[model samples]
Target: MALSPEDVIKKSFSATHLRRGYDETQVDDFLDEVVVELRRLVSENDGLRTDLEDCRASRGVASGQGAAAPAAQGERHEDAEDTQELEALRRQLAECQEARAAAERRAEEAQERVGAAERERDEARSSLEAASAGAAVGASAAGGDGEDPSSIISLAQRLHDQHVAEGESTRARLIEEGDTYRTTVVAEADERSAELQRTGQETHDRLVAEGQATHDELVQTGQSRHDELVQTGQSRHDELVSTGEQTRDRLVAEGQASHDQMISEAEQQRSTVLEDLHGQESALSATIGGLQSQERDLRERLRAFLSDQMERLDGSRPTS
Candidate 1:
């Protein structure tokens, strides 16, 4: 496996059987370099990620408003964006799941390492116990050989000190390893979460701005179109009304002329009929007067003739 800064910093060596472990100055110098490199890499990666996210956000916004779009087209664009967002969410979720899985694997590996370390510690403890028992037995044997009691006690003390020092070193190493792994895991997770949050926020802001821009554009276009339609309709209505007025005026004038002609013709016919009646009445009256006069003259003649006939009869016949 690749060694990270934490691993390098936390690396430990077993207590030497004959000499001290690794040189502390050399180890510290190497760890410092590793830590600086790790920091530089992390900073560079974070910067690159931020730049990439910003570029993507900018491109998405530019593409969204690159052309004049209708409302339906804009809705389709929104749906497409929603779909893309859902896909991105799914991808992010998958990445999170993968990261979680990786963390779990790391946790398992860490557990294994801890178990191994614990086992090693237990073995070390057992070895120390065994060594103490051996030293006691040796001291007892030395005492049986008539050795000095002070020397035996001093050997036992030396053995105890060595075992204690070894145990302390092993414990410290284990603690440092655990802390390093924990810090690395937690730092990585926090960094990833922060990056995701920042990217999501940027994307959201860009999308909102683009949507607002599109909405304003559509509203303006619709307003202008409505005004144009209204103007056109008003114009058409005015033209129709003017045409209707002209037709009405023409029909009214024609009707008036026809009415006047009919009235004049009727007046002329009435005058002619009245004059004919008057002339007929006058002729009848004249004929009636003449007939009356003739009747009177005939009556007078008849009376005279009757009288003459009577005289003649008187003359011709005997008087009666």
Candidate 2:
């Protein structure tokens, strides 16, 4: 099916998970290229169609004059040449259409892969969150289960440590995955960009060469038309090159920004998690310290009371 620019612009991908998948920005940039290529194809096809119609009309005119003119042989040869040129244009148009369709298919496949990765990441996050929540609730409930404060505190501390460890591991894994994926993507983009530039240069050279040859051959017959074709081909080549360069730069900038943003967010989240863990640890330490202080005071009071009771008993024994 044919894809439109709006479909690309409106497509959304989940952002919270940075698993091993196509970068969202890269995919969007690729879709943007596809859209540009599609537009170019359409425009070129329209021009070719118009040129074809003109050629047919010109041929009709030449045929009308053929009946009254003595240059029938020359006109017939010209008509055959026009037919060949028209066929070539038609073939080029067909190829452009086919390329457009292929590009659309690729874009769709990329979107699908990205969507699947996002769904998988979502599921993993949900499971981890649920597990952490359940563990927290269990730890809170254990304090009311007739367990001593020390045991409860120990259990809570272990759970906290476990959670912290898991968080660190997950964070590390995600960062590594992101780095690997980003590296791979950037490399591929660079390589692809270079290849495209080379291909564009080659195509431009070939087209210019062909235009020069045609201009030489038809200089006497249609010099103005030949010049126009050359100018148009040169302009088209320049536009394609400029567009490719602009796209490459934009994709590079976006990829860097995305990488930086991901790193910054991960750091912020890590900091927040560490801060909460530290606060919890500090609170538990204070509670334990307070309990110990109370126990020491009770011991001192019991010792003093026993000593006073012993002295009173001695006095009441009549100095024995």
Candidate 3:
């Protein structure tokens, strides 16, 4: 099974401790790095596995053609070498399968971690709501006694300050996570490129060696089988290279398209959010203005009532 980021981090820490002394904060930072690297590695591994599978399928078709060709002089001998190559390819395929499985497991674990993070975020939101509600209640109670307007205003200010602080903290955490994720993705891409280059080189060497062997055997026999093998090998090699390049190009184009789609979606969402915010602001302003108008009317009515009472009291105090 694939190792999770946490598992990878834990393993790294354990190994590091055995080799060196323990430092809690350092270990924690290292673990964070490990998680980033492990996620990158898993992503690259998945891509590599997909490419390898495509290569193998292409190779299978070439192998079928190679088998159908007539057995010429020393062709039987070449068959043994071909068998060896096939076995090697099988081994490589098995290794790729194992790696793919590991990567899939790691991906599942990563998803779980993401789900947990989402849950935590939800909990934090709930906590924030509760805190805001509590603050509102406190402010209402304080305002009920008109003698402490200053205290009520102070409480409201404190609530605003707390909310701003919490928002800043959340934004900082998101920024840090984004940075780490970007770094990890870049590293993973580099690693995958290096691996692909190495694999390509090895495949090229094997094909060259096979061609040389066939050419030598054909030299001793004559032009018929030699020309046939050379032609077949060249054709197959060209086909594989062309097809692989086209596939790679197509994948790249698809990826770019997907990225563009995501960007467009994000822009749309941002625009929607901004529009909603603007609407909310307008509504809030209107509500506040309405409330203020009502308060003014209420105050005027109170003044009229107090004035009338004072007039009555004045009338009651005769000759004053």
Candidate 4:
């Protein structure tokens, strides 16, 4: 089951309510680029298929005519030339298929990156939750301390969850877009190929009709034309492949860099939140210690006052 462009456009993610997450605009922009690149790849694939079909049809017609014609040394030489041309065409077609496969591989890689980012985000969220739970337990152990630290921890947890959720959502969206693009490109290529086949059949028939009288001359001319076309196609294919590779590399690099930056920032924020919590806990402990000291001093003072009063009372009783 392949996702189409419409599916990508309709894809949505769960909102991270009350949390800050990835920038929606940036995510959307990146998706748009993926769609555009997919479209370009599809178009190129279709064109390459058309060219391959044309070359095959041309070869078939040339072979059929050669079989019907008189076999001379010159004709044999021409046949050999035709065979070479067909071989070149086959090689070109193979190269085209390879290029298409490479493009698909790149799309898969993009999805893999999306998966990695999601995994990292999930890990971060889990770790933060664990840390928050730990802090809560420590606070409880310290005589069920005040709500301030707990509240702060709660807020930090929410923030962490929100950020992680946003990154996850963005990554999911990107994966969906890639799936959709791949499906759409393949379908379009198939349709274009069928159309090209029909067109090639009609053109082959016309060429056969035209070759009846001027077979030798046309063969020579066609060889020259075929050579020219093959060279041109090769050059064009090389340029397209080079450009596509460069674009893919740049996009992948940018995505990775962005992901790393986001993770680094999130870690820093979590560390800061933890530090604040620890500092507050220390302050509370010091205050409790001071209160205990004051309590002990008060107890000693009261006992001394009681002893003094008793002595005065004894002294006042003369008969005793």
TM-score of 3: 0.29
C-alpha local distance difference test of each model: 0.68, 0.63, 0.63, 0.71
Name the lDDT value of residue 216 in candidate 3. Answer: 61
C-alpha positional error of residue 171 in candidate 3 after TM-score superposition, expressed in Å: 2.9
Scored against the true structure, residue 56 in model 1 reaches a CA lDDT of 36
lDDT of 4 by residue, 1-320 (tens): 75445666778877632334468798899788777766776787677666555554443333435654554455567656655655655565455556557658878987898888888888888888887787777667764554666676777688787878788788988888888877776665555555555555655565465455456655664576567557877888899889978987997898899889877877777788789989999999999999999999999999999999999999899893
lDDT of 2 at 285: 100
> Which 10-residue window of candidate 3 scores lowest in summed lDDT?
12-21
Error of 4 at 204 (Å): 8.7
What tens digits encode model 1's per-residue C-alpha lDDT throughout 1-320?
75466776777766532322345797578569757766665575565455445443432222344454465576778868866985796577568657856776776676677667667767766776776677667777788777776665577667666766766676667667766776777677667767777777777787778778866755665555555545655665587568657866975896688678767766777788789989999999999999999999999999999999999998998655
* lDDT by residue (tens digit), candidate 3, 101-155: 5555655555566556656666666676676677667767767666465565566
Model 4 TM-score, 2 decimals: 0.35
lDDT per residue (tens digit) for residues 18-137 in model 2? 243346597768888877776776687577555445443332322333563445456557657655655665565456556555555655555555556556555655665665566566
Q: Candidate 2: which pairs clash?
A: none
Model 4 ranges off by over 4 Å: 1-71, 142-150, 184-320
Residue 255, candidate 3: C-alpha displacement in angstroms:
83
Residue 302 CA displacement from its true place in model 1, Å: 99
RMSD of each: 45.9, 47.7, 48.5, 48.2
The CA lDDT at 319 in model 3 is 86
